[model samples]
Target: MQDVIIVGGSFAGLTAAMQLGRARRKVTVFDTGLNRNRYADHAHNIFGHDGTPPGELLAAARQQVQAYPTVQLVPAKAQLVSGGPDDFRVTTTDGETVSGRRLILSYGIVDDFPAIPGFAQCWGKTVIHCPFCHGYEVAGTRWGLVYSSPMSLHGAVLYANWTDDITLFLDGHAIIDEERHKLEKRGVRLVDGKLRTISHDAGRIASVTMDDGTEIALEALYAHPRNRPSADLHEQLELDMGDTPTGTMIKAGDMQATSRPGIYVAGDLATGMHSVTFASNTGSLAAMGALQSMLV
Candidate 1:
């Protein structure tokens, strides 16, 4: 049995593997190779590797983790998880079964893209989610906040720091007068209409078209779409879950330990703040938690 089996190979999974590998613990990482940031041209806000392509950073991490003989990275998806503490079993897509003393879930989440035309093409480019991640890059540009939920009101207010030219697209959601006044008080333009299409020039948004034939020019649009865990193992394992504005995540403690023993979670799967740095940090903490459990 391996010391640990991590079900994801992006930022969080790789970081967990590195921590275990450095301690000479046998660990295996199963990755489907689909990272959430794959569409992003470059990753920002990550120290020491700011502006680096997301793929490049992950490649470097894979290489670093491979230096230890105890670690192995497998390009496969985890199909199911079973067993219990110190004897967990993971079945992969390739008809193979791997057992480990601990399991780290960093499979990440899948963004539920809106059905609007050109939205997917512009995602991670002229369309974004986090202001801190891509805000500065489009500072002073015409910005639009496509409201997905009431939680998005917080995003509209936070975005004011990056640009004053902000428009909030209600997208079929009703807003109370109090909230409307609050947004308008901050110089944010409010538009109550369902988005019909996003017109972009080569994956860079130029404008958004509403169902009522209203067209609003935009340099960039921000949206927080609901997401679900990439892997379905959470249900099979019966791990405790919590809800985030974007999706349902595994509930982990300070050390990234899930309510279930021998299972830990990290990355976007465990928190609302989705960033490369936070993912890596949580992975490290999950490793420490797993190690502590094993040592005791």
Candidate 2:
């Protein structure tokens, strides 16, 4: 049996595997290669590697982890997780089953963008979710906020701090009266209409089309897309999930230990504010926790 089996070989999984391997622990990392930030052209605000493409960063992480002979990186989606405590069993998409003394779930979340024309095409470019990720590029530009949930307003308010040119689109969603008034008072232009589609040119969004056939020019847009966890196996594992501003994240303790004894969650699957740095840090913590438990 491996010392640890890490599901989802993204930033978090790779970091955890690196820590465990350096400590002379055998580790296996399973991944499907569907990282949430694949659409981003480049990642910002990461120290030492500012403006680096996310794919490149992950590639370098994988290379660094594999330098230790104890770590094995496998390309497969973990489909089933069973057993518990210091002993766990993981089955992957390829029907391969592996057992480990400890399990680290670095599985990320899936982003479900709005079903509007050009929305996905412009995502991570002219359209983004996190202000810290894409705010500086479009600072002071004609930015628009499309409301899909109550959190959309919060995103609008936050984006306004970065740019004076901000517009809020109700997008056929109900907004509370007090919230509407507050938004207007804060200089956020409130537009009441259904968004029919997004018009774009060659992956760059130009404007949003309303149901009334009116086009609102937008240099950039912000949205809060619904997020789903990377694995449905969490339900089978009987882990406690809690609602977050982004979506449901598996509730865990300080060491990334879930209520389930041997099952640990890391990265976006455990919490929101999904960033490379946080995920990597959590992964290392999870690995250290598992290592300490093994020693005991």
Candidate 3:
């Protein structure tokens, strides 16, 4: 049996495998290669490697990790997870089963895109979620915010750091008078009504059309759509879960240990705040936790 089997090889899984590999522990990583950031042209805010293409960074990391003889990287989707503790069993899309003493769930989340046309097309370019990820590129330009949840009210506050020209689309969600007045005082233009479409040229957004056919031109639009775990393997394992502002995540402790023994979680699957640095950090923690447990 392998020392550890990690699901989701994008960021967290790969990092976990690297840590375990360095310690000469046998590790297997399953990846389907569908990264959430695949739509983004370049990733930012990562120290030293900032502005690197997301795919390039992952590819390099995968190559380096595979250099370890104890590490095996498989290009397959983990379909089901069973067993528990030091005897966890994982069945993949290959119809083959792999067992390991410890399990690390690093599968990321999936964003539920809006039905608005051109939204997905412009997702990473003109339509974005994290300002820290794509803010600097469009700073000092016409910016728009789609109020998806109460948590979104603070988006204008955050955007104010990068640009003064900001418009918040209530999009059928009610805003309290107090908060509304605060936004107005901050020079934020608030627009009501739901979004019907996003007009773009070559994946660059030009304007957003409201349900009533009102068109608002914008350089960039920010949205926080609800997301769920990319795969249901966590559910199949029946690990404890918790809800975040945007969606749900698997529950893990300080060491990345799930409520269930021998099972760990890391990266976006365990935290609401996502970044490449955070993913690698949590992955290392999960690996160390599992490694330390094996000694007992």
Give the top-scoring candidate (lDDT). 1
Candidate 3 structure quality by residue, lDDT tens digits, 8-37: 998888989999999999998999998889
- CA lDDT, candidate 1, residue 152: 83
Model 1 clash pairs are none
Query: How large an RMSD does model 2 have?
Result: 1.2
Deviating ranges (above 4 Å) for candidate 1: none
In terms of lDDT, the poorest run of 10 residues in model 1 is 148-157
Candidates in descending TM-score order: 1, 3, 2
**Of 1 and 2, which scores higher on lDDT?**
1
Could you tell me the lDDT of residue 99 within candidate 2?
93
Global CA lDDT of candidate 2, please?
A: 0.88
lDDT of 1 by residue, 1-296 (tens): 99999999999999999999999999999999899999999999999998999999999999999999999999998998999988999999788999999999999999999889999999999999888888898999999998887788988888889999999999999999999999899999999979999999988999999999999999999998889999889899988899887679999997999988999999999998899999999999999999999999
lDDT of 1 at 14: 97
The global Cα lDDT (0 to 1) of model 3 is 0.92
Query: In model 3, where do residues sit more than 4 Å from their true spots?
Result: none
